[model samples]
Target chain A: MRNNDGNLVFERTPYISGYASVVGKKEGEGPLRDYYDRIIHDSYAGKDTFEQAESELMNTAVRVALNKGEFTQHDIDLACCGDLLNQCVASSFAMRSYAIPYAGVYGACSTMALSMILSATAIESGAAKRAVCAASSHYCTAERQYRFPLEYGSQRPPTAQWTVTGSGACILEKAGDSHNLLNHHTELKSNIPPSSGDDPLLKENHRESQTPYLHSARLGRIIDFQITDQNNMGAAMAPAVVKIGIKNNGIKHGIKP
Target chain B: MRNNDGNLVFERTPYISGYASVVGKKEGEGPLRDYYDRIIHDSYAGKDTFEQAESELMNTAVRVALNKGEFTQHDIDLACCGDLLNQCVASSFAMRSYAIPYAGVYGACSTMALSMILSATAIESGAAKRAVCAASSHYCTAERQYRFPLEYGSQRPPTAQWTVTGSGACILEKAGDSHNLLNHHTELKSNIPPSSGDDPLLKENHRESQTPYLHSARLGRIIDFQITDQNNMGAAMAPAVVKIGIKNNGIKHGIKP
Candidate 1:
C-alpha cells in the first residue's frame, strides 16, 4: 500500500494469530472487563510487592497466550516485553523461566502498541515464526516509580488516568499460516469465519498474512506540544495518535477518508 | 531452521549496513578507543544534568550512524532504543527530536546487543526497510539508578565492572543491499574502498545491504544461576554469550567448529 505522504507502505504484512490478557480487579471492573482472560481479585496477586504482582501477571499472560497459540516456551522465536518499571524489571524477571529469545522494550503506556508493531514486523520479515508481545502496568508500581507512593494518600485528580494493574500478551505467527487467527471476533471485532481451504487470498500463494493482515504502519513521531501536565497522558499522546490516524486512514479535514 | 530444542531458525538473514560509536573521556582511554567516532571531554556534554548528557551522547551517536548510512529520520521505518536509566530516559529523550517510529527497549547493560538484535530482526522481516538501533550508558546515571550515587565513592570489589560512558548506533537495512558494509574492515583494520559498480553484491540487487550481514542470532535466555553478585556481570552473562556462540558459530566443546 502507498500513501500520498509516503507513509503506511509495507513490503510484507503479517498477522496476529493468538492473544491472551490478564487484568487486575480494577481493570476487570472496567468497561471491556469481559474480554480479559484472567482477572485477579487483588492487586498483589498473592505476591509480597506490587512489582512482584506485576511480574506474576505478565507470566500468567504469557502462559495463557502460549497455551492459546498451542506453543511451548521453546517455540517462542522472539519475545518482546516491557513494563512501566524503571528498567522494565517486571517483564524481564518474569521472562527468566522461559527460553524464548527476548527483546525488552519500553514505551510507558504506549508499550502495548510498540510491542505489537515490533512483533508484526519480525514475523512479517520471516525472522521469526512466532513472536510474543507483552506489557504490564501496576498502579502501585507506577506510583512508586513515577510519582509518590500510595502510602501518602495523595489528593484525587480527575485528569489522572488510573494505572490499572493489567498485563496483556499477544502472539503473532507467520502470515502464511492456515488458521488466520484474526478472523475471529477478538479485539478488532472482525467476524470472518475459518478458511474453507479455497479462499482466493490463500490461493494467490503470495507470502502475505491472511485476511486481517497487518499493513504498512505510519511510525509515530513524538509530538510533545509542551504539555507540562504529565497526568494528562491522552493529551500528550494525542498528536502522535492523530498523526498515525491521518497517515493510515488519510482523513481529510472536515471529511472522513 | 529447527534446533533440537525447537528454536525458530530464520531463513532470511539481515545485514549491518552501517554503525557509529561515541564515548566519554574515560572510555576514550579504553582498549577499543580508537574505534569510537567522538569522545566527549566530560559526562556533562554541556548539559545541566548527567541525564541530559547521556541523552546527548545517544543523539550524537545516532547522527554519526545516520551520516555513515546516508539516511535521514524519514528513511527509518523504526527506531529501537534503550538505556540504563529509569524508563530508559536517556534514549527516549534523545528520540524526541527524530521522526522515526520508535520502540524504547531496556536490558540494563545488555541494551546495546538487545537493540542490535531487535533491529536486525525487524529489517530481516522486511516489515521495515531500515531500522536504527542505539543504546547509551553513563557512569553517573547508572551509578545513581542501579547502585549508589557516584559521590558515595563506595568500596569496589574485583567483580564490579566500571560503568564507562558510551553510546553506539547502527543502521540495519534489508539484507541484500550491495554496500556489504561488514566486509569493509574499518574497525577490524582494513578500509575497504567505497563501493564500485562492479561489486557483485551491489549488482542485480534492488535493495540488499552490503556484506557483514547479521546472519543469525539466538535470543538469550535470562539465566539466573542464583548468583547475587550484582557486580559480577561476567558470570551472570557468560552462559548466554556462550550459548549464542555455540548456536551462531557452531562451536563445539573442546574443539572449535
Candidate 2:
C-alpha cells in the first residue's frame, strides 16, 4: 500500500469480510444517483412519504457499513457520522436504526476526517473494538438547507464550489496478531461484477482535486500535533501549476529538451 | 405570569394567533381548529404524515396553550422539547414552522423540568428576555420505537407507565415593570378557556407541579434567589416532583394512600 516515498501508507485489509452497496442507476449514471434518489424516497425502514432526506442518506451509509462485516447491530459499540447540513441529522437518525449506543458529530466539510479520527481513537483506546464512521452529502439536499437550491440556477464565482454528492462508510477493527478469515458462503459464483464499466479512479481523482486541503487533511499524518501540512496538496497546487509548468518548459528548452 | 406565591407560572400557548382552549381537549381545537391544523400540518411541511387522531391531539394541545394566553412565542427567546422516539423528530421538526430559534432536548420524564430550568437561566442571566419549553410523548409512536406495540399486549409492571399522548408548549417572559407600556403586547390574558370538545387528555394527572427556584450564592434579590447565602448562584429550579414525591411520600405517609 505504500508509495516509494517510504512513508506510512494504509489500505483496506483483504481479510475483512462482506461488503455490499445498494445502488440505483438509470444508465451510465454515477452511484451518487442511487443515494440521491433514496433521499427523496425513504430514509430508513423503507418507508415512503417522509420529507427529510438527510435521515435516509445516513441510513444507507450505516446499512452499507453493517453489510460489510460479520458484526450485527448488537455487536456495534458506537456509530458516528457527520454531514454538511446545519443540523447533524444524518448521524443522529442513522443511529436510530441500529439502536446501538451512538453519538452525533458536527464538523462541517471536515466531518469525514473528524469521524475517522474518532473511530481510530475508539478502537485504539479499547473503548470500542469495532467502530463505524460514515459521512454523506447531497448537493441538492444540503444546498436547499444551507444555501440556494440548484433549481435556483445561481451563478457561481471562481471561489464558489460544489458539494460532494455521495456518502461513504467505513468499518475499523482493532488490528491484532491473530488472523481472521473472511468467509463467502455463496456457491453460485456470482459474476465478478464486470469490473464496473465506469472508471472509479477518474471520479475520485477529479473530486479529490477539488478540495485538496480537505483530502490531505483527511489522509495525511501529523508532522506535529498543533499544525497540519498537506504535502502533495491537490487544490492548493492548482494556482501555481501553470507557472511551474512554464518554468520547467523553459529550463528544458535551454537544456537537452 | 406571577401567582401570589411569587412564582412565575406559564399557560399553554397554541399556534393560533388568538384563541382559548377547553380543558379535556387538545389546545388548538376550540374555535380555531382550522387555523391550528394548518399550522401543525405546515409546521413539519407535510414531512411527517401524522394520523388524523395524532394531528387532532397535537392541535388540541396547541389550542389549550393559545387560549390560556399564559405564554407567547414572542416572549420566548429559547425553546426545548423532545420525546422518547429516536432523533426527537416531533419536537425538532415541529420547530421549523416557528421562527423562534430553539434547542430540542431529551430526557425521558425529566424533559419538561430540564427545559424549564435551562430556559429560566437564559432569561435570568440577561442572555435572553423570554423562553419556551415544550415536551410531547405519543404512546403509539413511542411504543413502536421503545417497546412492544399495543398489538403485543405485553405484560407490564407497576413501575412502567404508558407514554403520555400529548405535546405541551410553554412561553416564559421576563416580568416587566408595572408602568412599562411594552408589557401590554406580551402580557398573559387573564381569561381561562374550557377544555371540552377537543382531544381527550390522555391522562390529566400527567401534569406534574413544577416549583421554580433561583439559587444564588450572593445577595441578589432576584426572583429565585435566596438572601441568606453569600454566593451568587444563578440557577433556576423546576420541581423534580417525581424525585421529591418518592422521598416526601415515603417519609410522611410511610406508604401510599
Query: Which candidate gets the maximum lDDT versus the true structure?
Result: 1
lDDT of 1 at B83: 92
Count of clashes in candidate 1: 9
Span of 10 residues, lowest total lDDT, candidate 1 chain B: B188-197
Report the number of clashing residue pairs per model. 9, 29
The per-residue C-alpha lDDT of model 2 at residue B62 equals 44
TM-score of each: 0.82, 0.33
CAPRI docking class of candidate 2? incorrect
Each prediction's DockQ against the real complex: 0.48, 0.01
lDDT of 1 at A179: 44
lDDT of 2 by residue, A162-205 (tens): 55555666665543211232122121123312221122542243
Ten residues in a row with the worst lDDT in model 2 chain A? A213-222
CA error at residue A167 for candidate 1, angstroms: 0.9
